[model samples]
Target: MTSTAAPDRPATQPRAPRRRALAERLLDTPLADALAGPHTVDHYLEILRPDWAVKRVRGEILDVRHQNEDSVTLTLRPTVTWPGFQAGQHVELSVDVDGVRHRRCYSPSGSADHRTRTVELTIRVHPQGVVSRHLKAHARRGMFVGLSLPRGEEFVLPTPRPRRVVLISGGSGITPVLSMLRTLTDEGHRGEIVFLHYVRGPRELLHADDLAAIEAAHDNVTVLRVATREAGELPTGWLSGRFGPEHLRRALPEDADAAAFVCGPGALVESVREAFREGGLTTPLRYEHFAPPELPEMDPDQLGTVTFAASDQQVEGDGRPLLEQAEAAGLRPEHGCRMGICMSCKCRLQHGQVRDTLTGEIHGTPGAEIRICVAAAVGDVTVEL
Candidate 1:
């Protein structure tokens, strides 16, 4: 005999806003705590709704836009608990796929001056990207995902806006700098602004119409769109070929002091840095890398043993990242943005030393936190996992 029963309603179902507010208030009161003695209020609230939490920040997908075959834009409505983000900061977004939670860092593309709690994230789907592909294929309105508070400080607008500003980006790297541009225009900035964006072709350009509108509305702005792979005659305001020193000269006036912000691929960032160096410009060139910088080959003789102190697991270092070695040893550790950007895989170095893969710097401080994703074992090392 089989029992026939109705399944619980999906947590994605919308709840009355006032009711949720009352419940949240009640949960915060001393009476609810006394009634639920010694148990977490979140555990019970989670049974009522998936997105409800006492301290964790979560957002519901409010809209999804397919920008192209390989990219998507998701608009999210974060819970009231969310701390607002700066124009150029990033957040760690987490989603569950096949019973495993995966997290990635993404910069919001929307203006920070908007009078709303919604955030926009434009994601490029890499061929091997798990979260990006999952979002492109399955993300929809009402889906809930975990979110971290805004987390970057370097790639932001200066306190006193420069008289002249140059913003450069390539591929999907346009998101953050686009946010900066939107914020500047929204604030009615009177400074001269030059925006340069590079893509494979016009079809791959993100926010082309919006960018054109911005340029048209603001006399102080100049927008340059470059299609690196296009051939033949190009239209006005559009150029063909990859970024080079010529493009740099076109974007910036000789001897003109301008603040610069760049975000893109490693090679593109390097090229821009080199261009600045070659030009002998003293202007600050701030940049953010979309991927981890390439690491040099590690000497095999320097490899040693890596010990997970908490798990009591040891593996012979193979000149690979500690995160990879721990995973090979059948230990599951929390990690996000394996590129070392999110700091999700950070662990305390309990004993011994480890080498930073990106900078080749060695660290051996006891109780020092290190990002395991980009750290390789220097010798017999122990880390609190």
Candidate 2:
């Protein structure tokens, strides 16, 4: 698992020759970003498979691109088909290494409509892992890649209009929230929506203008950002002092039975859910999570027992992967965001058990398991999520 927010490596290491410095910059005041200036389809395609027609490339590097070196915006391209997306859904990507495949999930940036031909991804990359590393290293345009059906309903649209919609997201976990935010506007959203998002630096914020534009276009829309790392960073339009239950309540309108879409770190989601519950805002708060609940790490020795539900077959492996192990045993499972964010391959445990390597907890739900992309196996576990 563990994919979100890449660490800064020493500049001494090898890096692609970038026209820009590729560093984070602050938004003292809203400033126009050059990266967002303009780019063509050909420009992005040549980023990997030089031959635009030959979109199949193995080492396509979809590096975590920001609006600028210091901007907070992150961008990516979706690798699937169309209508392209009607807003508020996810796409699963398959990362194959040495014939072993891993599923990684990402919320499409938005619908690939008649206006825009490319689907964008606004993700904070994780330094380690299969897809993240590959994307950070070789996700170039024009490279043919495997993708899954778009999935998820976290950002359900409100009918005709709503009092408002409040979006709460933390860290690089702003993907789904952004999609919903833009959806409201692009679809000629007539209702009001408030966005309370968290990012460490203003420079790292994703889609600055998009959010600003939404706020500007509609008198009903309000955009607020929080920077946890800054002390005197007084962002002009911040809603809460920090992100949490308290911040959410303060950010939304009082009488507004606003639709709420929440995304980000699992801990933040749990906390916000509990916080909102306490606040009596029980309107089924929509949430998106890319990771299983964080728990203690499990021992590798215990990660070799799993019984597939479809095949009625039991399999054991060397802490390799639940999806991989399943596939090796002739079971093809659906997956994306193999690191855990996508939630594409989540299944329920019909019987038996499983243990997560990164997060130590043995699955809690006996019937409903977890995203298979993130778990291995343990004690002849049976999976049904």
Give per-residue CA lDDT, model 1, range 1-385, as digits (tens). 8654435455545577767777878787767767876766765665678667765678899999997999999999887778787888999999989998889899999887757468899999999889999999999999988899998888888878888889999999999999989889988899889899999888899988889999999999999899888876677768888778899887888545579988887778888999999889988899987755576777888878888999988899887889999999999899877767778898999888888876678877999999999899987889997
State model 1's lDDT. Answer: 0.85
TM-scores for every candidate against the unseen true structure: 0.84, 0.63
Q: Each prediction's Cα lDDT score?
A: 0.85, 0.61
Best by lDDT: 1
| Tens digit of per-residue lDDT, candidate 2, span 274-351 | 877778865557876655456654566565557776787876655655787787888778765666656667787676
Best by TM-score: 1
lDDT of 2 at 292: 46
* lDDT at residue 207 of model 2 (Cα atoms): 75
The RMSD of every model to the true structure, in order and in angstroms, is 9.1, 16.7
